[model samples]
Target: MSPENNPSSGIVSQLESWAKRNINPLFSKDTWITLGEYIGLGRPVSNRPITTARELGSFVSSRSSHVAQSALYGYLKTRAGTRFPELFENPKMLASINLAKWHIYIACISDLAAYMGVLLHLRTGSDNDKVVRLMSRVVDDIVDEIGMPDEAGDDFHESVEALKIRIENMDFSMHEDGDAVFSVSPDALYKWSPIADELKRFDRTPVKNSVRFRWKDVRETARNLFDAQAVIESFGEPGSSGSA
Candidate 1:
């Protein structure tokens, strides 16, 4: 199908295609073969020909990359913008920064990595909290996959604990609305229920009021694994992970 017609058209496909043609052939084209190189799975641990899912899970189960994660979140923001156009439009956001190689690696498994950027900046109180929790889940899976740094693990736990506090303490009521109006607070607020209100909201269906992010950053951020072409060889191997 044409890219335009494919509902699944995404940066992931682009990366896969590029990797299939550009990466060196030393690894050959195979799922177990490639992952085995990345982690060295089960044969003898010492003489093993394969790397268990747990070994590489951290890199394989997270967002594809920081840039791509942001792009995905930006896309989500756009999806949300369709409903809350005013709030999402020109979304002023604080982008999320990845602290560990684990963060970038996990993008291989979950799309949540791509949304990290949005999580950092997109503010919608309870909804944003939900997104953060989901991303945290992705992070947790990554931790399970690779295990955490010995001393740093404690700090990591503390940080996530702090996130929990933020999520739990968030004021869902920060936003106020009425049958005929809605207003987002802190920086701004406004409500509209009629066609006129919506019309007034969008002077030109501006992408500004709606946040849009790019995935190229993700591609760049993941250049290391971007060279992995083995995913193409396996196609849909159950264990092979990819970002959207």
Candidate 2:
């Protein structure tokens, strides 16, 4: 079937439209600057009225990087309240747990982007080299903005390769909603092992498994966050007022 008529492609297009309309504005340059100013990261001296690119990038990273974890936390609080009561009751502990898993969350987001990139490529029948280059560029730009750890670049590439293999084996023709492709258990990118391990430390096996089963919700939230970042980056350079 042509991509236009394909259900998976349709879902991707719908997601893109929704993201542009709803999520993009949140990552605008003006929004970043306003947030920076609110948190005292802006205008420390009379000479500097506007937030610099580095400052803006840092602020955006600090806030946006937590989007997935925030969604997962809220999900656990509301839907799995009986199993993860501390998530709702102990803000300090929750903060500590999230901080500890910050890098894992970043990895998960990166992996999901790679997975989505593969899906887009499959749906569009794009030139493989061009698609790979575009995906790499996007990841590089995000890494430049967020500043990953020394080994994160390598780890991300490995995860991308793993996701590519998994996608190649999947039968997308059998799926109706493209989003359902992402809802499979034992996330293809292999980043979820760390997250599951973290949860296992505090909860019993069944609770951990239950939380793991909800990875799709966390993935969807991360995808939206990624979409917002992509939209903001498409406007202009990261910190320029034009990006607003």
Candidate 3:
């Protein structure tokens, strides 16, 4: 589609509108349900919390199209989580669970859309052109102010790698190769995971005393630890609902 012919314009526009309405520090659950209510499927969400995956699942089950449920969960999930702190702080853990469920939900819908040829990129390792392109684009917009990756420097890639190795190395069982140990690694140690290795193994740039580390700098990077496709595949396929 041409730049002017964006198919997601309507849906994407609606999403953007939701973002504007729920600007940080002043979110309202009632307003958040605008899109889901528009779809007229999920449970009636109010200013109250939609606490469990079961609740999320029940809401998902009551929906019609998988796409509809996916999209609704997208909004609910976005609003409910602390995944992006700038957007939502120390949010209840349930929100994070739901957000994860939402991501899984939509990723599955996107895959289905691609499977039916309605959307492409339904399968793994394919270019974003397949299915995630629109999503990746929309997600970029959705999380732009929350955590704009564009603003960061090239320093991210390696920093991110170090983080992943730490996450992966934590517990020899997790070693994709079943070959190491590290553990939760949190956010900091993960980034520092490689300092020792890099310093010892390669001629690395010395750490400047002035360089400050921030989670925003590391959060996106930490996300790189998991095999994204594998994450998607876990929730993919039609019958594979968000439960369990």
> 31-78, model 1: which lDDT tens digit per residue?
323323222222221222112222222332433333233333343334
Tens-digit lDDT track of model 2 for 44-153: 21222112222223323343344334434533444444344323235554444444344444544444444545543555555555445444444544565545444343
lDDT of each: 0.32, 0.41, 0.31
* TM of each candidate vs. truth: 0.24, 0.37, 0.20
Which candidate number has the best lDDT? 2
Worst 10 residues of 2 by lDDT: 42-51
Index of the highest-TM-score prediction: 2
Candidate 2 whole-model C-alpha lDDT, 0 to 1: 0.41
Superior candidate under lDDT, 1 versus 3: 1
Better of 2 and 3 by TM-score: 2
lDDT of candidate 1 at residue 175, scale 0 to 100: 27
Number of backbone-clashing residue pairs for each candidate, in the order shown? 30, 0, 10
Residue 121: error of model 3 in Å?
A: 30
* Model 1 misplaced stretches (Cα beyond 4 Å): 1-20, 28-152, 175-244
In the range 132-173, model 3's lDDT, one tens digit per residue, is 333332222222322324322344344334433332232221
